[model samples]
Target: MTPETNAWDGAGKRLYLQEVGTRDGFQMESVFIPTEDKIALIDQLSDAGLAKIEATAFVSPQAIPALRDAEIVLREIRRQPGVVYTCLVPNKRGAERAIEARADELNLVISTSETHNIANLRMTREQSFAALSEVITMARQAKVPVNVSLSCAFGCPMEGDVPADVVLGWAARFLEQGATGITLCDTTGMAYPSQVRALVADFRQRFPQAGLTLHFHNTRGMGLANVLASIAAGADRFDASLGGLGGCPYAPGASGNVCTEEIVHALQLMGYDTGCDLPLLLLAAARLPGLVGHDVPSQLLKAGQRLDLHAPPADFASWRDRALARDQPQTAVS
Candidate 1:
């Protein structure tokens, strides 16, 4: 295929963004964010016109105290008419709760590497997949679309390189078992642009009908770059967290997901239509520090957007005035 075919070029090409701040970002936090704050943030993101939002995850309260109130948060958030609110489901019980909470979509995560899988999920890869098959069945019965996020698809922190076929094979299994979409996650931020391009091209070629999404972390600082490469190579959907809030609690050296504003800012400047309100998204992101009780890792929050401008400093202005006065003619001054 030609290069143009992969790009969101010309007019009318729209890139879909799935905001995962509430679920992914908050999950890894040591301090628990209030349910009200979570609801408010979700409302803010929904108001920003994001196409999709990962609302929360259904897991054991003792396991992830930060997200223990998933049901309450999921139930309380004001649902936008066109926005899809999804939640992560770890197993059959989680899937049942997600179904009861009326989640618009069910996002299930499984690692491709055995070590990482066991570390994160507390189960082997095969065990996690078996559990996911049951979860997928439950989601199908409940009429809730399932989105399986394959973690460690790029490389594992422990096992190192996970082969391309392993990732594809896992995706194929999920699809066969009735998953509606696939999200390839760089759980430890090990993905590169070239690797992302090659994998995306292969995925599209092999699974032409499957809905594809890319999830990246900025741990290695390639999150946004990987996003561009993935999109340029024909993948459109992506997951980004506001203020770059989260990483895998189990994966060593893992970091927060790609920042939503940075992605939007970059893509908007490149002439792709995101349909997400960047200013509104920034407003939501600005609340991260207060809510999470710490400064977030967002580059956009620190650097400001592409058009945010500033005048010269006061000292520079004063110096410039003095220089102008000194350069003037002495006769004129006399």
Candidate 2:
């Protein structure tokens, strides 16, 4: 394993990294990336020490044409030890497909707002809950762990300002139905830092046993701030895509997710151990533009690292020699 940077030397906290690039990143792209490339990307991510990877979604091809090859990808990708490969499932059928693919974990999502829920799933909140209960039961019978994701947990684009009580109530129901984890998703990037902190704290208090993960988009440029707030509120797991790839089709004007490199750099700087190698992650980010056939939105990919200072073209070798000499005080003195 590559040594982690002591960037967070004084912060004294450990953060978990969930690389959602394969699933979330590819979901929104208009171009089709070959399954071979996806597999290669997952392998690279696994080598980077990300504990969890959201590999693919078993949603309807009619709904998400991009993921039509979910089963093929799931079956073909090489699974590395210690990395959890998770797949998103929309309903019972999707859950069955995920199980058939032998997915390590299943993520089932439902929107909190009734209007958004209906619009997205073509079912009422109550109906979706009933469907979710069935899906959870199926996964349990199949011995698959289920992660219940409550989207629009912060504010809904359709209904606006979803009540905390509503989210909490839905979470309670999901847990009662046997969800092993809960992921609060800011689908449209409508969450603020304070709201994120308050919600995470409340949920942590309410569901002590349930593993919580936060998924935020950067549409409003508060994604990292929200992540910091959530971390302060005791959240360790978070979802981020390489180059900030992904946006909800239902959310108008919504942008990509928090960039994986940005999140890792932030956590590392704050003394949180993400177990990711920054240089390797940057390499992966650099490959994204070519694969997606367009420039990505990740800041780190554009600006490079703080340590990546450039030397003038003239006497570049001398500049390097001087820097090396400076590192060796006796040699510099000589």
Candidate 3:
């Protein structure tokens, strides 16, 4: 293929993508992934050139048995330079563990909806904020960057629509607590492109100093659409899982996060630089079915990438004539 014909030849635009397959992707899985396999997969992703990777969550083994090996996974993976390895810390204890594990960043989550917060976090909205405050403080002291994810920022299953002010208010408090960054999560995939554009705009206006990361789900099949809208709204970062392997355990009916390769392929087609090796990401995505023991929702996995064109049939020149003859003879189904 000529240089002009190649889709990946240019760095059109820069977009930062954080791979969360190891943490969010594995948490919902019922099958227990062996630590060695998990380490192997993470090691493979490490060389994919992602700027950040959420290596694992520091939740209790009882809460998420699939990620019980967070410590080992964090310790064993080959830490590549210029790559930030982050972990989810649900509380002070998780923060301490993340600190010991040498996580480059600690991700703290607090739902924006009171209903979702009580159900999933087992705490009131205020209570979750208060608790995460301490964790953020500890991260600051430990010299670990704190990224707070506001779950259900778009809409909630229980609560129909989330007001814009409520999300920004919560983010303001988290920022006041010394959070280094913020991630707006469409936990149930209720976010549309218009909603995403508006939210990102308001968020930048309200909290201009804090870093923003947009987390989306493909529940309603708007994941990549929302990514484009967000990018247009000046959102530079995103969280996507390999093979669409994530869902909220607490949020009923919530499903997988956006597929990594799907959006990566879309961005690459549009000339955006996501800093990832698409072939390697797809290779890693190829192994998810075996690890989780089921098929995943990856468009690229089923339909090959745009450039993977198939050759015409052996008797290509006769196809049109054959079809025309058949149609002419069978006209009107007489």
Candidate 4:
């Protein structure tokens, strides 16, 4: 489909798409996507009009070997104008590496569950916060924007039922410590629609100016439902991966992120402008199965759109007449 020209107004109605294929999507894959291919994907996504792209993570290679080429990928990627390239940093060392890479933004993740936090980062909540503060300070010094993500904010696979107070308290502290933005991450795909609405509503009310983003996984098939709830609760930013190509290696049964093309298609259909090129996003999703050696879960990429059936049999003149008639105003007959 052609890009929308006068389709969206520039105002509070705008929705932002943050493409996470490079970080979240590729991190779970066994195959090693060359740094050149990673850079090429970022260039294509930038041209597709994505506002932000999580380019890579500066974590330990032992933790996630797929992203070991973070520095090379970040340095080689073509930085498009108006697109914010971000990197995930796990600790002070990771933050230092990201700073060396001259990353545009640094994203830090902290878990709400004590057990998950200890298992994931080998630290207590207090220790994680302390490390996050240091990383935020380092990013500030390097003039890079710092964003903190609260993982398992909805529910934890190990601990189960993460309380709202726990999430809100952590968010308050992160903001107090100078977080430029905050993302609520459903790390294990256990969040429900009602829970999403309540959390986002409370957070938006408390932190009016906070740059709020939601990250959802489709493990139980509630990813899109949660996204709708968050949007209704005043969230405008969301995280999605191409063809939903990711999962939490630490959290068993956790699936990949919400599909980027699926989310973009939903937003465009709802008249909430995302500025993403859906046709191009479909092309990107189509490439994922071959690239990763598995079929992705994106519906739009597989089934195509209902509107795509408009000109079956390739009759150009007849299709043109039908299209013109559909676009014209309907009149009452005598």
Query: Using TM-score as the measure, what is the rank order of every candidate, best first?
Result: 1, 3, 2, 4
What are the per-model C-alpha RMSD values against the true structure? 2.3, 6.7, 6.3, 7.7
lDDT of 1 by residue, 1-334 (tens): 4142545452456888999888888888889898999999999999887889999999899989999999999899999999999999888898888899999999999999999888877898889888899888878888899999999999998999999999999999999999989999998788999899989888988888999999999887888789888877888899999988886555555458898988888888878889889999999999999998888888789889867998878699789999999988789558
How does model 3 fare in lDDT? 0.87
Give candidate 1's error at residue 44 in angstroms: 0.6
Pairs of residues at least 3 apart in sequence or in different chains that clash in candidate 3: none
TM, every model: 0.93, 0.89, 0.90, 0.87
lDDT of 3 by residue, 48-77 (tens): 878799999999999888889999999999
Cα error of candidate 2 at position 230, Å: 0.8
Better of 1 and 2 by lDDT: 1
Global lDDT scores for all candidate models: 0.88, 0.86, 0.87, 0.86
Error of 2 at 43 (Å): 1.2
On lDDT, the leading prediction is 1
Tens-place lDDT per residue, model 2, 91-192, is: 889998999999999998899999998888899989989998999999999999999889899999888999999999999999999999999999988999
Over 4 Å off in model 2, which ranges?
A: 1-10, 250-254, 313-334
lDDT tens readout by residue for model 4, 1-334: 1122232322436888999888988988889887788888888898888989999999889888889999998898889989999999999999999999988999999999999999888999999999899999988888898999999999888998999999999999999988989999999889898889888888988888889999999888898888888876767799999988787665555557899998888778767778899998888778788778888878788778657775457688898899999988888871
Which residue pairs in candidate 1 collide?
none
Which model, 1 or 3, shows the larger TM-score? 1
Cα RMSD of predicted structure 2: 6.7
Off by over 4 Å in 1: 1-12, 248-255, 315-334
